[model samples]
Target: MAKPIVSMINVEKWYGANHVIKNCNLNIMEGEFLTLLGPSGCGKTTTLRMISGFELPTSGVIRVEGESVEKKEPYERDVNTVFQNYALFPNMNVFDNVAYGLKVKKVPKDEIAERVNKMLKLVQLDGFGKRRINQMSGGQKQRVAIARALINRPKVLLLDEPLGALDLKLRKQMQIELKRLQRKLGITFVYVTHDQEEALTMSDRIAVINEGVIDQIDVPQKIYNHPATRFVAGFIGESNILDAVVVGRNDTGIQVGTEVGNALGVSDDETIETGDAVSIAVRPEDTLFSQERQPGFSIRGVVKDHVFVGNLVKMMVTLNDGTEFKINRFSEDEMIEPGQVIYLYWEKEKGKVLKTRNLVNTDSHRDIKGGDEDEEEGYAAEA
Candidate 1:
């Protein structure tokens, strides 16, 4: 196995009385894009700061290439950071800003120009060398900042919400550009972001940080489709948490029951036991609505509201237990009116039972053997 490029072993950080990070252990592989993802004040940025050498851990060790870097200065380590605010030197033009690092390192003038031009070209800023920092747009300035950071050829790049300042459109564009740059350069990237969509779109693996601990770490698809915790399921995307009791567990799957109904649940955990309290998650988009009965786990609900949202429709359904859930459907699907009793169903494979610290109460009658054939066919294309 290839050794990890960076490792955090039992890492802890404290700000006087407040514990900012708690017993963190992470391994960043070479050339991988790993994101420390969470909401605001979740310790993600503090973790990033620790790795960049700006803030030392109150306890624990951080290693770079199999050696401890706790006592090293930020510049002494082979890493660079790009912040939300482009942090460019306003006094210098693009060329001078990007070349500042090399000049400080005392690289010869001829070599500095060659390296600077190459970096500019790599960031798609080929001929903007003489442009003033103030004259460039937000995206242009961000590109210049990226070029400046990459000019030094750091083995790792740490970004803390680097796209937060840009408009939505520009941020999306930069996300793709940054992903391409990481792949082409093959440098490990440790990204920090509160945006779930950005993490899902660009990360090779996502380490979801909650409070001061890592909730889960996995590839984007696995993280989205098979969340390991209740927090992971709720944070990565929208989920309808169903509270239930375990009826039985087998090699195939487990059976769970709510106050009003019961359904089959599949768990990644093989240790699920009978009579255990658990919560199952069903994505709103994974739900299908119909007047005719369908097969698989299901529930009967009265449609409370239908909200038109561009190409998507948001539905509010209330079960007999008053457990309300939000379901999403394509706008083209004929709308079901409020006060209408309808069936909501999903396949056995689409539902997940979780054993996190907290369990939710949810109820829906399931008809596992009856479904609309046409609706089943459309599920793949729409979902």
Candidate 2:
């Protein structure tokens, strides 16, 4: 079994009187890419800082290689952080910046030059070592930052939204590059980001945080398909949530009466009983819509509108009580139009039932936002 390279046991953080991270626990395994994903002010960044020794926890233990890190300073820990701004010195060239760590340790000049060149090559900045920081592009500077951080040969690398400043196209390109580099190096990475797609694209596991609490932690597919909480379902992706109450149950699943007056059959949970309120989440792509009534589908709604968005079409259907349900389809072969009534259906198992009390009291059709500012820790001198 792979040992956990980093562990946070019952971690808690407080900024003065404000409680930030609340009883957060996690284990990042060796050589795996784990992403701490959440919206602004959700404590994702703070959690990463705690691991990197940038911020100290108010309570609980943080361990690296099975040893506690609570009493250690940032530079003493066997970890390095790549910040969003790259944090390179304009006075130094790429080679100097990459060689700074080795020079600080008083390594021989010949060895420093050899390691710097290899590190630069690893990040694809081999021949550009002589170029000053100000002369490099955003993507190149990001590569330099990563190379510099890794040159120290730390056991773990902490990236705090390192691609955030790049343009959309460049950001997408760097995502692939960063993932490739991690796989090649076999180093444990504890990444922090608010972008859901970025997390899904690069993570071996994702810990979804919200309001100082972890809502769920799992791989991308599991987090998307079987979200453990209402906040997770709404936050991770676009979900059509039906606020419902359990009406009946059989051997297969439980039947729930939604606020829109439709009965939805969802996979059963032993703890859920009739009269219990639950939220049903169906992804837009999983929702099926047809002009004619389909078997096992009793829900009726009027077509609101649909917009062609690249490879797929996005549709909006309004229920009788004015709840907007969304659907996504590959093509408009059925040809839906506004004011036309349609029947909605989905596979029973696809309708994920979230049986939890931590519900976000919001409309099903809107984008979910995690409230507050992500703790912006002051940047100190790097080790």
Candidate 3:
């Protein structure tokens, strides 16, 4: 097996009494694109700073290229960082900006010119070398920042929301360009961003962080399809979280009862048992709607509102008990009108039962056989 380019072992960071990063352990393989994804103030940027030697950890060790770098300064480490604000020299042109690193190292003038030219061309800024930084656009300046970092040929590159300053269209274009450059150069990239779509587009694996803790680490598809925690399910994407109770279990599936008087047979979670309170999560796109009842568990609801959002229609359906559920239908047909009664159903395998109580209130959960009394009382209590 190939060795990892960067590794963090039980790393922790604190700003005085407030803990910023808690026990972060991760291994980034060589030549892989890894993204640290989370909301603002979730320690993603702090973790990146620690790895780049800008902020030393209060405890634990960080290794780059198989060597511990706890005592090294930012410039002494075998890594380079690209910040969100492009720190280019306004007075210097693109060539001089990219060549500044080599000049600081006191490299020969001839070698500096050749390497700088190659780096500029590698980032597709071949003819823009003489253009002043102040005259260039936002996207052009970002490319100059990347080229400056790459000229060092470091073992690992750290990016702290480098694309955050660009507009949406330019950001999308840079995402593709960055991925291509990483592949061609075969460099290890440690990226930090709060945008889920950007992380999904560029990362080989993502570490989802929440409240100074690592929630789960996996590929984009696996993280979306099989979230280990309820927080992860709700954070990564939109999910319909329902409070339910486990009534029975077997090898095939487990029976669950929700506050809407729907007894659902969902995949069994090994940690749950009979009489255990649980929360069930289902994506809005996984449900099927009809005018009449279908086989298995079904809920009768009236379409309270329908919103047309370009490619998809978002419908808000309210049950008789006043419980509202949001469903997204991807169709170009005429929108479903409000006040229309509809039946909503989904396949048993499409929903996941979660044992983590942090997702929903346990006291409001209802039993399957409790009928109308359970629905009315539980719904009222939640309200």
Best by TM-score: 2
RMSD of each: 9.3, 8.3, 7.0
Clashes of each: 14, 2, 0
Q: Where does candidate 1 have its weakest 10-residue lDDT segment?
A: 360-369
- Predicted candidate 3 versus true structure: per-residue lDDT over 68-163, tens digit per residue: 997789998999999999888998999999999999999999999999999999999998889999999999999999999999999899999999
Q: Which regions in candidate 2 have their CA more than 4 angstroms from the true location?
A: 267-269, 292-296, 356-383
Higher TM-score: candidate 2 or 3?
Answer: 2
In candidate 2, what are the lDDT values of residues 1-383, reduced to their tens digit?
Answer: 77888888878999999999987767789998999899999999999999999899999999999999987999999999999988898999999999998999999999999999999989888799899899999999999999999999999999999999999999999999999999999999989999999999999888888788877777899788878777789888899887776787778776777756655556434667786667788999989877777765578999999889899888889998898999998888754888998888888887877664442211112212222222211111110
Supply the global lDDT for candidate 1: 0.83
Candidate 3: the clashing residue pairs are none
- lDDT agreement with native, every candidate: 0.83, 0.83, 0.81
Checking candidate 2 for backbone clashes, the offending pairs are 41-373, 41-374
For model 1, residues 142-183, the per-residue Cα lDDT tens digits are 999999999999989999999999999999999999999999
- Evaluate residue 304 in candidate 1 and report its C-alpha lDDT on the 0 to 100 scale: 95
Model 1 regions lying over 4 Å from their true place: 290-298, 358-383
